[model samples]
Target: MNTTKAQILDGKALAKKIQSDLQQKIATLEPNIGRPPGLAVLMVGDNPASAVYVRNKEKACSRVGIASVGKHFSAQVTQEELTAEIHRLNENDRVDGILVQLPLPDGLDSVALLHEIDPQKDADGLHPVNLGHLVRSETGLRSCTPAGVMKLLAEYNIALSGKKAVVVGRSILVGKPITLMLLEANATVTIAHSRTQDLTAVCRQADILVAAVGKPEMITPDMVKPGAVVIDVGINRVTDSDGKSRLVGDVAYDAVAEVASYITPVPGGIGPMTVAMLLSNTVLSYQEKMTI
Candidate 1:
């Protein structure tokens, strides 16, 4: 057991360090910027998960001295209203970042709404322009979760160049962007999705493996290669046989940790890192706007 246990990549610690650095940078720049960096999070309805996430973001902004210009709209709010709000925020001098909280309402078109936000002010970094910049290897705001994964990997000095990296799941959010990032770092990247054949064989070949498929504890120990660096980015809530509920990632933490050289915990891993990257992106936008 002792021999099998892997080193823990403490994302929470790295996130704290990132936030502290951002706070210091904000303090130093706020004097010249003339106003605090502002992030506008627009939530259309009361999604419990989204509410929790928004609250955490607001609290993080407060800690970093950024202004939270949050807007909570009724579930019945129309698409045109949300688009107008995004336009207003795009033109607002005080707001550096704007993001529409995910899973907006049943009738809402999330992709359209995301497109409405100006790419320069897109805090989540999911806009087509930013994604295009990523594909072209140009500097641009990046999707928070994938950026967090890259940051975590960097914090531990994990070498990505020339390594075989496999990303399970091909979603634009975490999987696709992270694959591109790994490729940019010169790692040979393979992205596997639900339809992929021989998934276990594919995953075992990776020196660096990232799981972001949103399934709870789906990647077992057998799927992992010994001495591989494992980054789990899935956050899922599951109830135990005893009816106790808790969060878990796509990789089976305890089992996979034994086989992998490094591992990240469920709740304390990518979740905090995602929030940290959001703050970083906001600050970056703020700096860009102030200088221009």
Candidate 2:
């Protein structure tokens, strides 16, 4: 008997469908609510990657009929100024969601600014209060990347209940939150980091493995369990033989795909889903406001 290759989890197609569904919901809410859901994005400095991400988010908001307001501050902007801006957005009636792009300029405190945003308007779901809600298993906004990953899993009908899951990486933005989400779904979760010994052995035990270590090709075929579902969350740029740069994931897709039962491709996998979930968060924030 011969074995078949794993199925590919197409995030692009799912993201497209999600955007279309959001557009219809936004259209319905606009007339009755008297205004579209508005998202305020605060970007500091000019990191090229950050610029691309912010632009993509703006385009996603436009596609779903949500109004996006962007505020670009200089690298020299003071912490006081940044916190003040967040406070302003918190009080703005029209701003349904607020997102502060990560990796602020040197000397600026990202955590302090994140704490200043009203939890209700925290579109990125990184605020301590919102994260606390997730940790407590309460109903509230979740980090976009983790939410997107879970959405992808649910779409494929991957059963998480009572499964063994290994998440490589412990970052607040992706790893820790994802582990929590998996646990919420009844999966026994293990979070591995740079300090973990025998990481490969731990990963091989997972029924569902998530690679988010941010190192290109760090999770190879040897780390994967036969028939395990693999989700790649790392997006790193590397120079090709021609000296041109390209994006790749934490997992070695070619090698891992040969063994895994299912896999998400880089660029098209977690990337688009992140944007889709952000739009979903905006709509959810609006709905929450209406109920109050």
Candidate 3:
């Protein structure tokens, strides 16, 4: 029995290293900029997951010497109020980056709120301007999760040129941006979504397969190509038969690990990298602001 496990991409470790690097850069820049780079994460409502995510992001910001200007609004906050707050952050010179936490209160329009943030301060990189820049292959703030995936691949020297890459999702947050990044790296890109027919056949042809669909363990071992590089961008909380809940990615880790040459584990994978890229984007904005 061949008991070889795939090499872990180790995103947590890389995220730490990236943070350390950013810390040093901030240290040097603070002397010139006169203030630390600032990031504002606005959260609406009291969703437990959003609370935890916001806390984590603020903690990461503090660790890397970036000042956190985060705020939590009431669930009853109006769309006009949120948009007004975003406009305020966009105008705040100290705030190098601005992000609105996802899944705002039911009546709130998340897209309109995101649109109000200045593209330069749009740290989440979901602004239409940034997305347009990505499509045109021009330099701009790229979405965090997909950018983190590309960074991990580059760190490990995984060759994307002329390779068959498949991304199994269609979310603006991950799927679309990642496909663009892969194409920029010279990969033949194909995106399969919920409506994709013969999803298994489509996935099996990938040399580089990325699962960003929110489904838990949707990509089984059979969907993976042998010796392929698998990147799991899904984060789903699942409870086992015993009733203990834990996070798991879209891919069935144990089964797929046996066949994949490389893979990213959930919890430690992509998650930390996403936070790291947010910090990077904030610093980039700070650097540009200082230069101007």
Which candidate achieves the best TM-score against the true structure?
A: 3
Candidate 1: the clashing residue pairs are none
Task: Return the TM-score for each candidate structure.
Answer: 0.98, 0.98, 0.98
lDDT per residue as tens, model 1, 153-235: 99999999999999999998889999999999999999999999999999999999999899999999888888999999999
Clash count, one per candidate: 0, 0, 0
lDDT of 2 by residue, 122-234 (tens): 89988888899999999898999999999999999999999999999999999999999999999999999999999999999999999998999999989999999999999
lDDT of 3 by residue, 1-292 (tens): 1268899999999999999999999999999989999999999999999999999999999999999998899999999888888888888889999999998878888998888999999899999999999999999999999999999999999999999999999899999999999999999999999999999999999999999999999999989989999999999999989999999999999999999999999989999999999999999999996669
> Judged by lDDT against the true structure, how good is candidate 2?
0.92
RMSD (Cα, Å) for all candidates, in order, is 1.1, 1.2, 1.0
Tell me the lDDT of model 2 at 269. Answer: 96
Give each model's whole-structure lDDT: 0.93, 0.92, 0.95
Predicted structure 3: lDDT? 0.95
Rank list by TM-score: 3, 1, 2
Residue pairs whose backbone atoms clash in candidate 3 = none
